[model samples]
Target chain A: MKGLLPRLIKRILGGIVMILVVASFTFFLIHLIPGNPVEAKLMQLETAGVTPLRAQIEVQAMYGFLPHQPLDIQYIHYIWQILHLNLGQSITYAGVSVTHLLLEAMPWTVITVTSGIIVSFVVGILTGVIIAVYRDRGISNALTLFSTFLHGIPQLILALLLAFLFTTIWPIFPFGSPYDAVLTPGFTLPFIGSLIWHAVLPVAAYAISSYGGWALTMKSSVISVLGDDFILASELRGLKPRIRIGYIARNAILPLFTTLTLSIGFMFGGSVFIEEIFDYRGLGYMLITAVGNLDYPLMAGSFLIITVAVIVANIIADFVYTAIDPRIRT
Target chain B: MSAKLTDRSQQDFGLSPEVACQVRDLNVTYRVDGRELSALREVSLDIRQGQITAVIGESGSGKSTLALALMNAVSSPGRIASGRVTYRGLGEVTGMRGEELRRIRGKAISMVFQASQNSMNPLTRIGAQLLDLARSHDLPNPRAVLREAGDLASRMSLDADRVLTSYQHQLSGGMRQRVGIIFGLVLKPEILLMDEPTTALDVLSQSSVLEIVRSIQRERQLTTVLITHDMGVVAELADRVVVLYAGRVVEEASTAELLRHPRHPYTRSLIQAIPRLTGDPGDAKALEGQPPSLASVPNQGCVFRERCPYRMDVCETILPSFRFDGDGEHRFACHYEEARHD
Candidate 1:
């Protein structure tokens, strides 16, 4: 316990450093691009019939920094503002703060992708073990063929196909937005029910598309594990089929740990195509608009959040994997 | 040590050194790339009651295959084509299935595998794995079972508390092998098949493990089939020795008799290959050729003919059968056994 504490602390601190590096890199990269956010906002002011000089003054006053300011000074000011949790206003959505907008949309993307990943991971690993144990059986053969077919198809295409199938062809699920617009937002059961109801199509798309990869990995892992001497020993001990499978799965699941963590990290960035196809308002949906409009602060803020999520997830994976495998615990 | 076992086996079963398990012309074959490769070619041998029988052979001699065949656990591509593995009081094990096979395997026969590092799940604590085995066989009173495991560990000279709590990787190579041995014997099986148990151990650890095995075999009256390439191990621990060459039993005799007078050329070569402290180093002889691979086994004649120092013209065309002499206690599979013995 004592030794592990120092290692855990080091990992967490390293994760923070990674998040900071990602934030600074994205911030500088977006700013280094030819177009400026202020200039784009100035054009909006000019179209509203404001004089060029006054529009320039308005942009300077609103941003609290001139376009001609030195890059280092702007970076320092940006870092200062970031430390204060003030991500500045969004140039795309007038009068809205990037931080507030990101917070509002964070939950939707988090819930959808996390739930989808969990669903896929659980179902894929279970089915993969089944397929491995029954590799020669007809049913598993059919499943392997289907999963291979699913794995080859791109996720975006799968999402769009599923959306069209469920929303237009079958008319079984709700089409657009995370929830009904008419419903009052609170902690009510109906509101949460409506929210989940609307999220079905997009979540299912993510899960079904991601399931193939996890299942294939698990099948291969289990197949290799089946050849191990411990497995034979377990069988020789007269262990029931279920208990033997449990032992096999426990060992086989180790290699999949890193993959699962990275996928969870990717979830924070969310699935943009799924969000866009279903018109579900989430970080991925916001990211597309931010990119199109070239909202620097908004884009960088969301990227920072996603990068942090991924880094923290990876750290958790390292610790959890070490905990699970005694060979690595030392 | 062996005389006591022999006398007891005769007195108890009254069949004169009663057979614990009999392998009746068990033929195990492997199909590789559409070709049938014979791994064990119509091999028949007996594991005697309350006696240690050492299956001594070089690699690829199908000694390990013989062990797996006894347990009915030949993996994919390998099939027991035709033969019977008869376990006394349990009937035939070759075609046995379901609860009958399970029951036989559970409390009747257990095997300790080679490569001790891989024989245990590294993620599980040793105690938990032992407990799991107990639970799997529906052994009642879990607490009592675990206590017995600890006692067994202590008997093997392992620290009971530390060994039970630690994972496999936490133990040294020899310790893990001991744990594997203990686990194999936890159910008190009638037949214990130990496949090269001390192959990877240091001299001290090997002797220690050998001592533990000897004591256990005596205490429980176990019918142990010990597989080894080491003639020294065979001499030290086995009561009876069966020499296999290219998937066939070349010689089977009492250990003392075989050590004193090895009939087959291959068996003589194996005995000569063993290094001795008392003998001059230059006296050690290395066998000339590799053991025949399963894929390239000769279609006719004695498999050892290619490397036999005393190869005869008839050895190239005909396979040898077991030739018994003097009360049929010692047998050698060689056409010129009479010439060689005389």
Candidate 2:
């Protein structure tokens, strides 16, 4: 325990440094965008037929972008507001705290993405195992072809297609939005069910696109491992077919575990386009809204969350490697 | 435990009272690129209880095919086309599956192949793999079984705990082969098929493994069918030798009799091919040419006719019937058996 303390401290410090670096990078990149919050607000007021000069002055004071302010002073003020966790008030959503708005929408995003990943992995692995065991059979060939077709379609296109088929044409599912407004402002089973129902098209769209790659990877791994001598030896030992399959598949599937972990990390970044297509109030949707309104704090917060998720996922994968393979531990 | 086993031990090293395995007119063919290649042709041999029968042949002579046929594990594009592998002592009591032919496999019979390094699971501890085999066969008291397995490991001159706890990659090739042998023996199968079992081991390891196998065969009364291209192993271990050439058994006799007076020219050439400790002073005689390609082999006549030094018009036209040389158990499939004797 005493020996571990230093390593643990180093890891924590490293993690903090990574978070800060990512946050700063995101802040600077978004800052480099052509328009500012004050300019966008002024443009909005002008479009609303307010006096352009007064509106511009009001927006400048609101954002501390008045004439004669030094760039260094403005940067200091921006950092101070960030340190205090005060994402400036949104121009679009009047009087809404960026942090509160994100927090409210975060759970929906987590539920959809997490559940989608879990479902896809399980389905993909099982299908891959079956395909590998019965390779070259009609079922395997058919599934491979179908999955390839599904994987070839872009996620946004798939989302829209599913929405069209399941929502507009068939009217079987809720087209857009998580909840039906009647049970809003409080958590309820019905509200959650409706949310899940609405999320199905988007989740399926993502799952269908990703499952093919996972299945192909897993099938290839299993095929290669089955060719290994140990699998044949296991058969010679007179192990039952099921037990033999399990042993071979377990060893074969180890590398896939690492890939799965990495995929989880990447899923955070990937969810943006899918979320935008569905117009779901998730982190991706929140980030998009913030970008449109030039809400830097919310954008930075979302970027930070995703970056941290990716790093943590990679660490978890490393730990899992040691856990699964004793050779790695030594 | 049985009178047959005890009586067999009391007698000279010979086939035991009961027959363990019989392969009659066995044929195996492999289809490659729309061509049928006959791997084994009318190869018949018997393994008596508590005896080691060696099938000696060169590469592509169908020795491995015969071994796989016994195990019923010939891979894709290769299959047993004819013949029934009959087991005398092993029956329904072994709990072999119906259609799967698992009846003889692992319970009644088991096999160890040539490549030992590739034969054990690298990820799993040897003990766990052993336990898996034991429990799968419904063996009782797995912990006790595992303990006995450790004891068996020790008998093989391996560290019991180290071998049991170690993964496959941790052990040397010979150690893994010993484990494989022990695994086969632990099941107490009636017949053990060994396809070049010691082919991959070092010379020292080979002799040690052979000794272990001989000892275990004696103690457990296991009938073993060994396939090897090595004449030295055949001379040392086999009670009877079946010489296969072009998938057909050209000669079959008691080891002493066959080595003393090999009738078929193929068998004679095979024995001559073995490097002598005392250098051969006689005419340098070795069989020329590779075994005929199985796919393009002619449908009629003796398969060895093309390569036989004593080839005559009759040899190319007709397949020789297996003829006894007045010794009831000694048989040779050669037209000139009598002529050669003269």
Candidate 3:
């Protein structure tokens, strides 16, 4: 107990240090891509009768950074902005701050990722335990086979297939935005309904693509727990089926939680694919545009969010795991 | 005294013919790969009231199957095919099912599993598990059950508070075994079946735990069935010993008499296998040949013929019927006796 605060401090310090390293790496690595956003924009402005030097100045002015500066100085500048919680302006989104753009787009991703995770985790663990309890049954074997098949399908393929099927063939659900453009955005029923309606496909893609893995992992975990001596002893102790199954699920669900949290960060990264495919205007979609336009601030900002998220989720998993499993509490 | 129990000799030996549980022709079978294998065939024995009856057998012997059968708990593909476990107060245990069976499991005939270290729910504290058991049996005062558990632990020379508060892993193996006993006895059940209680413990822990079991059994006058392969354990605790060979009870006698004059060839070999420091080193002959597995037991003859030193021609085909001793407390099944032996 005396070491708890120190341990927490060490963990949070490690996370911060990791985020800084990732930021510097992202900043420098993107710069190594040959031409800067200024160079890319300069060509377009050059054809508009602007001088080469003027075009460079205009593009630099847009993001408010000297693109020609040395790598170390720019790294220091990026770190300084990060320390101030200010990710500089987006070169592509012109006049918008990278922080603002991310904040605006984060919700859509959060909604889909969180919904996908909750649905999949609940369904996955539920199915995992059910199949494990009835492991010898034909239904369990068939369900297990189905889960394996679904889990093997790549996320990209799943997303693309979902997008094609729903938007092209069914056309019942809308695409290209988080909600209907006709309705004014508020706490209105129509707005929320459309929001949920739009999320179905992307969320489906995430839930379908990843739930199989959760179910399979959870299945093995549950099966092992079922075979444990305590389970038989529980029966000998005359523990009710409800109590027995609850204990089984409790122990079996422990390992999957770490995977669940770690997936949150990966879900953010996955947003680049799902959000783009569904045209959901989430952080991932903005990141794609930032990469295409070579928007240094926005790209660096997106990568930073992902790195920090993963690090934070990992830290949470470590703490949560220790809390849940008494054997590992110390 | 009643004519049935008029023999004070049996009473003086701390046992009686008053059977607490009469396992009559219990046949438990396990079906593996579509083939039914006999785990326990015609395993009959009397667990006398207030007597520790040790079922001694090799690993493959159906000691555990008989113990579980007392609770009427044979898992799927393995079941009590046809049997009547007439538990004195509870009537036929084999006839009970579902809720009726579940309710009496801990409250009437509790079981302390083999290597009880693994028998505890790892996630919960010892107290919580006790409360869970109490709740299941619908015991009104769960707090009293917890107190009784603490008291039981304290009496058994454990730190009661620490033991109750701690999880299963936190407790030592010996402590966990003791805790397992507490779970069984907390409901104050008349019958306590301990399956190899000391198997997973060190020699020191084993003795201490054995002493605890001995003291507890007397304190509550529990009708116990200690299932173990170790003859030393059988010598130490059992008032009566039932020697099981390949799922069949080959001999049943008072522990003293059985150890002194083991009539069955299998029982003789088992007793001989026990190493003693005082005896010549070569005098201890390790029993040759494996104990018959569930699938390998002969269908038409004596199960111990393969491992018996005195193998005869008649032993090959016809099964031997049980023959009684002068005391009638001693009974054995073997074709070749040579004489009355002792």
Give TM per candidate: 0.91, 0.84, 0.92
- Least accurate stretch of 10 residues (summed lDDT) in model 2 chain A? A60-69
For candidate 2, give the lDDT of residue B20: 68
Model 1 vs. true fold: TM: 0.91
Query: What is the full ranking by TM-score, best candidate first?
Result: 3, 1, 2
Native-to-model Cα distance after best TM-score fit, residue A308 in candidate 3, in Å: 2.5
Q: For model 3, which pairs clash? A: none
TM-score of chain A of 2: 0.82
Q: For candidate 3, lDDT tens digit of each residue in B1-342?
A: 335424522332322358787877899999899998998988777788899999999998988988888899998878888877877656677988897788778888899999687898898888888888888877879899989998889878899999999999898887888888888888999899999988878898788878988988998889999999999999999999999988898999999999888888788888888888696978887899898788889998788999888888888998888889957899988889734453
**Best candidate, TM-score-wise?**
3
lDDT of 2 by residue, A1-330 (tens): 133456556766787678668756765575576775445667788899989778756554344343235655755665555556655544556656665676777777777777778788888888888888898699999887776777688777887787778777898977656778777745778877887788887788768877887788888988999888778767766787777877887787798987887788667766787778777778888788877866665676667666766776666666667666755533
Better of 1 and 3 by lDDT: 3
**True lDDT of residue A324, candidate 3:** 78
For all candidates, state DockQ relative to the true structure. Answer: 0.58, 0.49, 0.62
CA lDDT, every model vs. true structure = 0.83, 0.75, 0.84
The list of candidate 3 runs beyond 4 A from truth reads A1-5, A38-68, A182-186, B1-17, B277-282, B338-342
Winner by DockQ: 3
> Model 1, range B75-193, lDDT digits (tens) per residue?
78998999988776556789877765665574678888897657788789988888777777777775676788788899888899999899988999888888888888878898999
Task: Spell out the clash pairs found in candidate 2.
Answer: none
Q: Candidate 1, after superposition: displacement of residue A35 in Å? A: 3.9
